[model samples]
Target: MPLLRSNTADKFIVDRRKPHRNSDVARAVRRSRDRLSQRHGTPVFDRELLKLHAHAIVGSAATIPLLVLIITAAGLLGGMAGDIVVWAFLTMTCYAGLTWVAHRVRKADASRLNTISTKRNLLAGHFISGLGWVYFATLGCVNCQVEQFPIIKAIVLLLAMAATALITSSLRGALLATFALPVAAYAYIGINSWAPIELVMTGLLALSLPFFSYVASHFNRSSVMLLSFRSEKDALIAELETAKSMSDEARRRAEEANMAKSRFLASMSHELRTPLNAILGFSEVMSNEVLGPMQNPTYRDYARDVHDSGQHLLDLINEILDLSRIEAGRYQLNEEPVRLLHIVEECCHLMELKAHNKDLRIIQEFEPELPRLFADERALRQVTLNLLSNAVKFTSTGGEIRVRVGWTAGGGQYVSIKDNGPGIPPDEIPVVLSAFGQGSIAIKSAEQGTGLGLPIVQGLIHMHGGEFELHSKLREGTEAIAIFPASRVMEVLPALPTRKVAAGGRRR
Candidate 1:
């Protein structure tokens, strides 16, 4: 019977061991699934993860001296200084090793940093460093005989543990592992103590765990959100840069096309002008009967019409070529000293016949003794003629066209042409100033034009260091003014004295 009982006891022990082993296996399976889920679901960028590890290691290195001080102040180190020093040395060694790992990770290729093994190593380093704090909790101040030493030591440890959790909060798994072991040991020590104060300290430490966990969770959420925002910002910047590059390429192509058009027009000018000159010359000869008498009176009338039409076409072509040259920066000016009064008078005389045909009067308002202007003579004449022609073309029968030349407010000179015609609408001013753009008023008027006048005027004035302005009101009148800068006005110098010779041919 005794033999039978020994066998039964052995069987019973084997049965009990089976469940324990099975439970261990099950717990490990659950842990593996949790780690896998964490890895797949909440993926952090490799750089941020590495940064978290480096921060934790550096923080641990900095806390070692504080821990030693706490132990020494508790008087726990009086007899255990050698052991404490050894523990401190070991903790620092671990920190230095982890720091070196962090440095290597930081310097490694980006592809290497994202590997699973690299991340695991970082997690392992953090977990081992946590073990050092657990060692401190177990051996550093656990043997203190003084009544208040345990409380002081526990409080310091709890604070340090909370700080560690916060520092490594960007890595959730590492943070949980880091504080769990030390806090558990501290709680166990507090719970089994005989003193009420120690028990209360233990309760407080237990209650504070959830609070620290919440802090870690909060920090983790914030960090994840910030990383997401940063990633999106970088992506947006890349897209904008791509769009800008494409737009620049398109703009370059457009500029090339425009330059090609200008070159084509410039090349065709000679081909177009030669035929127009022939038409004008032959029509003039036929109209005036310079070669022979026309057999029919109707032939003379037809020849005259042909001459006028050819002249108009020639003017249009000239305006177009002049505008193209100006735009191409090839219209060089023969600049000289010119009197504004004389130019204005000449332009008026040229336009007077057209104005009289429409029964309009030309009015002149000249400032007395105005200074001569330094400018392009031909360009100034064109500017004046264009303005007067427009005034005559737009003015109604029995209307008045006023031309003024005067000193401007800032010691500069100005020439203004005003007309009582259908004035330009304010909104159409820019349209009229652009090349080949006509205002509604000009379009509706009986007389029509090529509409290159104002743009040409503006370009010529700009080249001469001057400003051009147009002011008009609806159905009231319009005024076009060209203002020359003070620099372009020739100041009169005092005349040199002429020395009189005493009836002898000698220099004075």
Candidate 2:
């Protein structure tokens, strides 16, 4: 009983990290209640492990005397080693076989079938052990001198009888009623006079039943509490992880919306400027010479001023449109294999006249074997023009601008425009790449611009799956480079099967 009680106490050990729940206090209460219950009922054993210990205690107490009686009755103290050996083997073999069968059946199936199999094994072990007692009884009766064998034989008979009584009890009842048989049997046999005294003693064990029942109830409550605590802890951790994921997704979506708004504004500007350009171009022709300089002098001058203003506005509109298309994800690349070196040459030729006006020199350097690029030809040309124009526009007279074309370390084509003008500060690099952003030099100079050139160039390079890089130090000039993936020049053919139309028949 104390062995069972100690297992119950082990459950009360304190875990220092979790201080709120302590097992020790619960154990103390259980012990106090046990003592009180013992006074009113039978003794309680605290755990299931102690039930086996109880069986061993009962078995040893009953078997030693029975063996002595059998030996005396058979007159075998002098020469009966074989009989002793046989009895020992019989007892051990029966116990082991019953235990093995129980284990195998429990593993093979674990539902009602297993429960039935387990109880059957328990009954069988008891039945086998009882048979050994019965044999000892018969041997004692036959060999004992006088009256000595009766008491011992009677105890063995009581054990045999009760074991027989509950062998076929229903499964649920067998769990509760099995304890009664062994207890009743031993008590009746131990306390019998000419009667079976041990059998009667076993019956008195019924007095302890209520206390055992209370102990069982407490154990069940503790198991339920432990299971529930584990479930709640798991749920709480899962909820926290889900909340963190949702918060991260919301922040990403907000950033995307802001970028979309900037793109929309830029696109509107471009669309508005296209029509304005036609109007301005025709008006300028009429004011100058298309209609012979007009007959009214004042009307001619007004037309000339209007044309100039319209042209300026048209330039601003085009820049805005370029920015919008890039942001909206509506910018399409006209991919084809084209020589990058040729593109650089064209840019230089177009800007040579402007550089000459400022007394600046334009230098061009191209790698001899540079590969062609799969990119939008028109966009690439516009990117080159923007960079070269900025270089020429920023540099003072006699300053030099260099355009270099080469391949990148990552197997891409690179085009860089360098100027001898005042360079941007390191801190202002990101600002200059943004829409409407002016660098330190540009802000200080008298040059007039919409501040959209670098932003537009960066957007165009990104559309081609490339990068735009700028390196500068104040008054040391700046370098802007656009790097593109390499490609091969080939005759145009039907489109390959790369496109996958969405459910709505649109390309995502």
Candidate 3:
């Protein structure tokens, strides 16, 4: 009953089978497990060990019964011990011979039991061997005839039979039969033949069945579980290696793309500037009456438009190249001593006409004791020009623009440009500083701009190791600030040309 209720019994029992494949299910399971181990790159089990186990199952089943017969015969032949000695030795020899054969069978093709084909063979061999054991038990019972022997001896002979069937082959069936028949026969022997020790031994053997079944079930389950876990771990490690490789590839591609973009910008800047210089130069000559004056005022107007549009295009191209160099981290600085106040004055003077045309007032506030700062003159000029131009562009007619230049001790000098024009919207101020990003005002006004000016100003200032700041509110006005480190500011001045205006819009 314990064996019937056991986990292995529950799984391997006839009722648990589907009836159609029940006869061959164990064989199929063994074959499938073996094949799975082979295909999955798992280490294969030793075939020799499996075959040895199989032979041991069959050989032990057969030998157990014969041993019982020999012992019973020995007891019965006691009276004619001397005369039957040779026969007994002959019987013992046959038993040893069969055992030796079983050992040889086990040794043959030991690796074969782990294969799918061999596992089926092993299972079939077990069943057939069990049937052979039943036959052997029948022989012993027939030879020890019931009519000649005492009933007790005959019964003891029958009871000892259960041991001949090795429990390892079909564990479930072996366990049940081992307990049932042995206990019944032993009980009969004890009551009828006064062998209580034999009854106790039989009882003890029956009790051992559940413990062995429990241990065997867990062992099989543990083997399968460990294999499953190891397989999953290996697959996960492989996937991680693949992902790391892809990530490294993506980083390499990003760097290459950035390099290509910088090369394109440098090439485009040169190409565009070449033609633009020729157009502006020709326009300047024409405007100066070098061709004896344009015969028609319309011709002059056309020439002026050409000059202005060409310059505008050139400015856009230059800004794009500047931003490209900054993003690529290839922009270099030329350090020179610069009069901070003078540079601020030059920017105000340049934007004077544009401010007047818009009717906006200009105001300059310079701290008289400002120190000469070390900086890149061309970059500072561009930064100052951008701030002034943006302020003028957004200012309404009759607004005020204020320019301030001063020093912040221990750190740097600051240039502040403030305008009371239609100010930047709070949400869009940061966006306007980004490349190709414009504010709501510029979009609504249909402003003709490439949107690269502010970004270039920020880049130029940062290259000088300075801070560029902005403060604005919608419709109020914007304040643009630049701060440069004092240590980078030059301590000595070199003889430089005085700031000169382009006389009548012509560079001198």
Candidate 4:
């Protein structure tokens, strides 16, 4: 009455475990990731690092000139505006050269770059800039009006060191190369002056240089890591693309093969059936003694066997054609309003002779006064007969086969045919339900079957927007239920009200 669940097979269960087919692709991706991770200093990433260094220098091009202007303005307050201007001019000239080199490098292609040579040139430029700072270390006026000029100069040098570390972080060893000379110059000038403030500043600058260099190195490593992650992401996307292409290729081949099979079967239907019908006709005449009595009884018996074998072959051919039509989406449904109970009952009657032969008893139960079901009448008949035949064929002698027709809780209609046959194993339910598939019991039985009964039934039910469920348990029994939705169960319409016209040809 509730949603009649198929307990025999866990058809709705999705298995998360699947055989992995992309091991080679996965291994290649891993290998690529590992190689990218370790190849930071190699030619590929070296080119990337160079490009980043160039961009960093060019992007913040205004900062250096601005710092120089501020320093010149501060020095002008020393009253030696002439010396201050000269220093600014020379320093500005050095920075202008550095900026030009960075801009050129940024525009240069990978082919033009020699990583080692380019790095050396950049390092030399930084060292030249360091010479400018060396001059700054000794440029302060001792007797100037400002008392903290030395401290200001020391702070300025430290600031410059910090900025250079940030700017050249992408290019390895550039920070140390730039500030190495300046720190030495500052320390020498400080120790000679014998000023505690200068000496203390000098020691601070000495320690700060290495610290800033380490910071730059750390930043460079971070850049390498970012590149690694980016490369891995690109690799994954590429692998996905390759997989998609391969899948498309396989699908195209499969579709082509399916089309070829359809064409072959279409030709074979006429080819095979023409000869088979001849075989059946000749065998039937001989078996029935239609022309005359056979001379030998053995000859008559052989003719009967031939006729039976031909009939079986014909059944198998018909089943194959029906399944193909269903699978190829060519099986169109001719839906009509029909009695569900009557059709199932009739199918039971049709199969009664076969059940009687097997000494099996079929019990039929129908819900009375059920509504007409909208379905393909022929398909419904075939579905019921297939199920019934399977029951009669497999059911043991004196076994009871129960058939029920009733309304579902959802107001839908269902027909269930259950038999106390040597039941299907739980694992074999799927096999039995597949086209040309048989269970171990069916295999061992003396009964001959093409094994397409349940599958054809399932296809027919599906065509009518219904569910076909096969329930079975080892040694207990098997039940095959075909359920049609409420939509297919046509409701009885209300009778129309009639009124007579009063002396006119019009109805009120």
lDDT of each: 0.75, 0.61, 0.63, 0.84
Give lDDT tens digits, candidate 2, residues 1-508: 3543442322223222323333454454454444333321122212121233223324344343454455444545544445545655565565455445544543442222433344455555545654444344334233424454444444544443333222221122322343444444444445553354434433434444334434444544453344345434545554455555556656555555556566456545557766787878887887877857577888878888889889878777777777777766778888887878998898899998999999999888888966567777899899999999889878888999988998778667789999988888999989988899987778888876788999999899887878899998777899999887543333346554544434335733
Q: On a 0 to 1 TM-score scale, where does candidate 4 land against the true structure?
A: 0.81
Query: Model 4: per-residue lDDT, tens digit, 133-218?
Result: 87877786755687767788889988988888898899988888877887888888889989999989989998998899899999
Q: Evaluate residue 240 in candidate 3 and report its C-alpha lDDT on the 0 to 100 scale.
A: 56
lDDT at residue 396 of model 3 (Cα atoms):
86
lDDT of 3 by residue, 157-276 (tens): 344333433333322233333334434444454456455554554455445545545554444345445545654565555445555555665665566566767777776677889999
Instruction: Indicate the worst ten consecutive residues by lDDT in candidate 3.
Output: 11-20
Better of 2 and 3 by TM-score: 3
Error of 2 at 255 (Å): 6.9
Report the C-alpha lDDT of model 1 over 24-122, residue by residue, as the tens digit: 444445543433334313434655555655655565555645665565544434455555666666666665666677667766765445657776777
Score residue 440 of candidate 3 by CA lDDT: 78
* Cα-based lDDT at residue 361, candidate 2: 92
Instruction: Pull out the clashing pairs in model 3.
Output: 47-110, 47-111, 48-110, 48-111, 65-164, 373-489, 373-490, 374-489, 374-490
Better lDDT candidate (1, 2) = 1
Quote each prediction's TM-score. 0.81, 0.47, 0.51, 0.81
